[model samples]
Target: MNLVLMPMWLLSGSVFPASEAAGWMRVVIAINPLSWPTDALRGSVLGEPAGVFAWAGAAAF
Candidate 1:
């Protein structure tokens, strides 16, 4: 599972902002399940409002 999950975590934008990713990479980031909670937590810590999609994605998992 590390093989699958590790890449997902790496693509989750936890290390870098998704905005800085290339177009195709951004698409990968968008589909990564981990990105949702990462984005939600990042937004909470940064005092930015998390998007509805972020919450929904997190809740889905």
Candidate 2:
């Protein structure tokens, strides 16, 4: 489940807590512990299908 989202700051200054509200979003990498780009798994093209967030598995389809 790859996500291609622009940085919240760019979309809306409210994304952050305190800022000038410039509203400049960018494509930032958002990864969970289970699926992240890590050096430990160098040279690997696979990742665990899970989320590291504590409440990530609250529900399932």
Candidate 3:
């Protein structure tokens, strides 16, 4: 995404300073840690934290 942004910034007569750009990238990454296997979980019809609940169920029995 930053690669995409770079060309636009060059054309726009403006640029995010290097330090600010890196900080923006870090914020984007931090929003999605991916520490949990949340694939297709939040938007699925099940509409619950299925990954966590499924793990708990497997451990319970």
Candidate 4:
């Protein structure tokens, strides 16, 4: 599972949040399933803006 999720994790900006990454990387992270949950969780815990669209994307999947 870890191996299977590795690409998503790396692309999701978990190690280096989008803010510090390149524009292309941010674009990739935006579409990564891993990023959605990570962003949502961060938003909830930090009271920041959540990745609302992530729920829709998850639903689609």
Report the number of the highest-lDDT candidate.
Answer: 1
TM-score of 4: 0.72
The reply for model 4, stretches above 4 Å from the true place, is 1-4, 57-61
Q: What would the per-residue lDDT of candidate 2 be over residues 1-61, giving only the tens digit for each residue?
A: 1242343222322244223333332222132222232312221334434343322422220
Q: Which segments of model 1 are wrong by more than 4 Å? A: none
**Counted clashes in each candidate structure:** 0, 3, 0, 0
Error of 3 at 49 (Å): 51
CA lDDT, candidate 3, residue 54 = 40
In candidate 4, which residue pairs clash?
Answer: none
Per-model TM-score versus the true fold: 0.92, 0.14, 0.21, 0.72
Q: What's the lDDT for all of these models?
A: 0.93, 0.28, 0.39, 0.76
True-vs-predicted CA distance for residue 9, candidate 1, Å: 0.5
What ranking emerges by TM-score with the best candidate at the front?
1, 4, 3, 2
Show model 2 residue runs off by greater than 4 Å: 1-3, 6-10, 17-61
RMSD of candidates 1 onward, in order: 0.8, 11.4, 15.0, 2.4
Better of 1 and 4 by lDDT: 1
Error of 1 at 58 (Å): 1.2
Off by over 4 Å in 3: 15-61
Two-way TM-score contest, 3 vs 4, winner: 4
Q: Which candidate should be chosen as best, given TM-score against the real structure?
A: 1
lDDT-based ranking, best first?
A: 1, 4, 3, 2
